[model samples]
Target: MSVQIRNLQSEDVLTYSLPLLLGDVRPPLAESKISVCNRRNNTSMSWPVYNGTFKALVELKPGENIIELMFYGEVVELVLVYKVPPLTRFVRPVYIKCHDDPHGDFQGPEDEDCSAESACQRIALGAKLIQTLTAEKLAEHGFGRKTFLLETDLDAKAPACHVFTSSLSVACAQQMTGAELWLKFACELMSAKTFTQKENCKWFCFMSFTRYEAENDSLPKSHIDVLKQTKGYAALGGGGLALFSTGNLHCWAETLDQVPLRFTDTRKIDRSKFMDDSAYRGFYWANYSTGLGSSLHELGHTFDLAHTRTGIMARGFDDLYRVFIVRPLRSRASSCSRDSSRLTTPSPYSSRSRSRVASGNSIGAEPCFLRPLPTRLHSQPSFPDVIHIEVGFAQLPTKLTQCYTVHHYDGSETQTVVTRQSDGTETRSQLTLSPDGEWERKDVKINQLDAGKTGMQVTACRELPMAPSALPHSAVDGPDSVQEFVLQGQTPSDAGAHWHRSSAVILNYHKWFNEDCEKNQGSSPEITGGYITSPCGLRLIELRNHDNGTVVHHWEFLHDDPPTEFKVNLDKVKDVLPADCVECSVMVEDSRGNISKKKVHFDDL
Candidate 1:
């Protein structure tokens, strides 16, 4: 018997192909999922081909195979083509559901077989459905600093945490080795709670997982529930909160074909024949555990330690024992060449828990419940009332200390000032009080002090805490440390471009001008990298101390690169310089830089 098959003629097939066309890119009409159908019988077709081109394909029977192509959702374009194969291959109806984790309902079903010509239509529809679904999910979360997302290589069982101001999210799966490192360096080490007067810090966190785990693993549910219970952990850091509604976290999951974050690639760690493979696997396992340990060992880095051969906090460990025992060195010298005596000796004040602590001394836990406490929710109060006054300064022989009272209406004002100290104290400062000195008594009541109508600006007297008779002398100061670089201008009318200025921008500017630029207005500035799609056609001028403390240097205007001119813009640079000298510059290719100085003159606006 001879097998004879031929393309189904339009008359023989119920399904007829309609050309897919692009529509105006309206919000609702931007994309969609499509189902091919037969106009005569109004029956749907199954198994349409999906190609990115303007064409779609459907299978048809031996005779007429013409099918009407129907679309739902938004249409970004009208120039679509239908690429149907020869008739005789008609299959069952295709499911018309939105591409959801579990999928959602499409507009309708079709009776006609999917024409081979509908492949482009199918592909376009699938792509549009995916993008639509993903975008809708991302929008549910504000996608702001309060909520962050991370795409990581953490495995299904790995633990992850997202730190936010009002929200927190913990990953359900066990953590990957690098993810553990990120938790230590990004979460535990750099968190604001790890520092005193955390006002100087700002951070948001997120841990991502592979799609298979996010969808199938019950971890997000369990972990998010755990995070929901962790009020104690959340309260420790004002910005700490948890959320598990997956949008930003799961967007990538929808695109990937049910793969783990590292599914496409697995890290190949070089193992030695001299070492046991199980033991080597144990090394990774131990690292995962130790990472959890480091999360708990939140010790603020007050020590200037470095990586030594065999110390906790050292760079590499010989085996699992060292991974648990050693940590990253805090002191620059702590990890340097040393004998066994110097290797593991504890300080006089060292305790068991203190030995392995990270920089903040914060202890982390598996997201869990907290004992409900009747405490006030300390949220940001109304904008703080700031008062500026010239107070008397008493100079000591070694360092000068200034004391002044700023009356607070709500008594919620806080203070943090950098004091000049000896070496090893750059990261911290200690209040030096005499044994006989009154610590609490030193806090003056603003109401009791004599004052002007606005406030009291008193001549501060310097008295020795140790010896009252000793006169406090001031260091002969030269330059005004408080400097201001103003960036004030209207955002261009064409607001299509992205503009992001992080606090790091200020840090970069400090590096740009070095000490010559002095202090910026306020402790930090709000403005950062400036961007625009349309040119406003404006130039910037940099202002410096123009004194003995300042040395003018040549700079240039640059975009996405370091300046090559003799002047710089405080508002334009994307990054900060690493060093303090003008000649000591950031790489042109790298955003790290000594940010330049730019001031808004009365006319620049």
Candidate 2:
């Protein structure tokens, strides 16, 4: 029973102060377990070796780390050196608390620390998890494990609390939509002299004041469909910021050791105790992943990464724990395929009557009187521990080989592990998947809006009002909405292009831009049907379920080309729309940096 570190080029490695995801040796010994001891911290834990592989997150210390891998009886020692990246850019983990709210408490149960300080710690840890995931993914794509840095205090202590008091009353902020809150926070942080010294940086902002008003939440009478509305919270990423709420922060683990146990937790969520802002992903762990994973997805947006067909950039985030822990997402599958999608992370981890002490702190969270897990989860364990190894990592961006492959999608590709030549030396020619198998990722180039250019043009256009849209057809006629409308685009080569004729013409966009540009808006300008100086053309369009913040599809306009004359017509997308697309959002940015994000409901059509 033996498992060893398989991918690092050397036992002595230089790395970031993030979670070290150690993959098992290929054709692993037996399906047993291994003991990992971090000599620096004297923390040791047993990790299960599932299938032909096993993986675990080994925490590293700054400067130097001595990690011991004890397999059954044999022991292998590996040395790792940790260092903060020299890059100036970083992702700041922040918490936004409401003004005049003394408690500054986030949503959580009795034993949990829902205070602003606790929220900062949780935010910092969650930020590292996603940051580690990003690095592992980049390494998987053969990018040498590159990732952004995290901002720390002068003392270099982190999960550092960067608190901002909202000018809006606690009640007002609590009532604002995720978009509204995100916009407000982005505005405040950018203008803050204390926070803006860094010329270019991104943020993982957390809202500590959001809460669900269950009193007004009217779920249908059917007890089977008891999901609630997730207002006042958001899971969006774009521009240089990713925003979310602490409503579900309680589901996240406070310490690293608690991560694995948290992922496999099968307890039912008591809404009063644990806020399931994630709606259907009602388990304690699922909510943890939903909020954390969705936030990472949005952070990808801030990086200017567009959605790919798969990987974390898509919906492959459900099993981030699988990358480190040998546990399946304790989902309950029913005979009804119709409900299978809704049944992810379905029930309690086990049906066996275990003592209530299993829950050390969450009192009575898994009482038998409460609902049970899906009856269909194989009690005997017929599935391979690694079958769901991704959430299975066997996927990609067109190219693949025994080892490495490059992708055209902005340098994104599946990670390829190195194999040994007969001499025991490594060779890139012998590329292969990790002992745990594969991981995939792809993203489009994200670019910041040229707000300076936009400003100069806006100033010039202030005296010259933009012409009303010269669209062949108008798909917008109602409300003066910032996030409701359709968009149409065409290549200069395609003179006959129309929204209904080509997919390249219609989609959506939700973006983040400097608030400074917003103040210079043209007089009487409107984004939708009202007025426009210049149709800044389309740079990128994303199709997503805004409610959950899942980006469905992404379209990018390379070479910075955008259509000069476009239209908003939902009627054109009826036949060519993507599956399950009930609606689409569109944002039109004029020369003045004035952007109008609009939505078109297929139901209305």
Candidate 3:
């Protein structure tokens, strides 16, 4: 007869229980043997027949999981398929005003001094300008398309404004203000309700305009702080971007906080006489056009982009001109690419000099009104290296070994063993790495008959020295060392000796066994019991005596954490045993995977 699968069917879940039975044959089901294999990943599990049935929990990968079942050397196959869930994206817009005037209302072109037809158009133009220059570059660089959308709240006329009553310079703001404070202020002012909500909306673009003197400009520090805070917050759920506008270069002081400023006169100059120094140079000085360029650069930083040598993220007007002016003209032989042409021809700015300044251009008949400027190149960005260490346990019959694996981006790795000396000093020994990039040590021993626990530790580094003087004086700044406890004991002091010869053997143990042991008895560290926790739970096995003490009945139990007082009934196994059975043995396993056994005779019944 062939192997028989009793409870499982096709189309099972990624994680489910599987039950199997030996052929449709004899009275003793103990002879039935089965082996399970995950054909897709080449992983397998085996189980010995227990009583009249066999069962195990199986987990499959996302795609097709081909499971092979072998019973009595006969093979059968089953397939299970799982699918990944779809991703949802959302973009939120936050308008912020950092100015000295609290009652100043946001005005548009339709308003007396305003030039834009509507506030939405003004904000939308900024967003479009940003997308025009960055969308293509980000895609070509393999960072994937932009996943954010900018939607304006038109009915809400004025943007949320944060007033600063005191005189604060850019340097002072950097020293006093933090990103967390800015986000808190923005969230409160904007009435941002969904930040902590369950929805997928997380990315927020914060556009801020300030009326303070450009010399005292300190918004850069705030921008950096906001990005740092938002990135950290994103690790949990939400992230944000801060875009600051300082109005136009004309409103700025000649020198801000002792730094010199340079300006170029663009009035009535012939188109053919245009030179490289035709634009202004001041810290954080940008008219509408340059403001958009600077805003795009800040937005790039929020996207994990580094400053390039010559793109929008590059320093100074020369780089911005290359990105916003020269690059587009060179790419298109005739008319500017639709985006660049939109800026020069129809003009998104209003029909006024201030409006032109806001757009980073001067009023002129010459197309591409912005001219290149002289500026120095900035230093390239730098990144630090990191290493990760992982610890695990490999269990066998007699002993348990602690395994350590150190991973680094660079190929090189080193291992070190630390030992405490008799004179209260510590000594270190370097170990050679195995072919598989792992190091294992069997320092903790298991009696297999007693419940006990022990601790182990290992240190890993990028390099080791042949002489003591070569070692770093301070280990804190050097390689990493990890320490954890290893449990090798059983619970319920009399677990093995409690089994009685009855219809059913009921075993009761503490549910909060490990937690209570750690907190009250100081047996080990406080650990939340789970599949990965050492000495996770207890296991029980039953064996019935057959011909010459050959085992006939086998049963086992494995759990993360048992109840405070739990009982296991074995009536099913008792009914399957033969009347001639003379004796039986029961084994109790502890959370540390240690097993202890007890035997009882039929006469004891």
TM-score per prediction, in order, is: 0.17, 0.55, 0.28
Candidate 1 local lDDT, 1-605, one digit each (tens): 01111112223312123222221111222122344454434455321112221122332232343455444432211122222222221111111111121221111113111222222222222222222222221222221111111111112121222222212222322232333323333454345352332222222222222112223323222223323322212101112211111111111111111111111111121121011111123222232222221211111011111111111222122121221111212333233232233212321112333322222121221111122334466864767667887779876445334443332222222332334333212122223332234233223223222334423332121110111111111121112211222222321111111111111122223221112223222221111222111121111122222222121211122233322222224332212221332322211111222223232221221
Q: Which candidate is the best by lDDT?
A: 2
Supply candidate 2's per-residue lDDT for 20: 61
Worst 10 residues of 1 by lDDT: 461-470
Stretches of candidate 2 off by over 4 Å are 12-15, 25-33, 153-159, 216-231, 272-274, 277-279, 328-605
Comparing 2 and 3 on TM-score, the stronger one: 2
The TM-score of predicted model 1 comes to 0.17
The clash number for model 1 is 117
lDDT of 3 at 241: 45
Whichever of 2 and 3 has more lDDT, that candidate is 2
Task: Give the Å error, residue 38, model 3.
Answer: 56
Computed on alpha carbons, the lDDT of every model, listed in order, comes to: 0.22, 0.53, 0.32
lDDT comparing candidate 1 with the true structure: 0.22
RMSD value for candidate 3: 29.0
- The candidate, 1 or 2, that scores higher on lDDT is 2
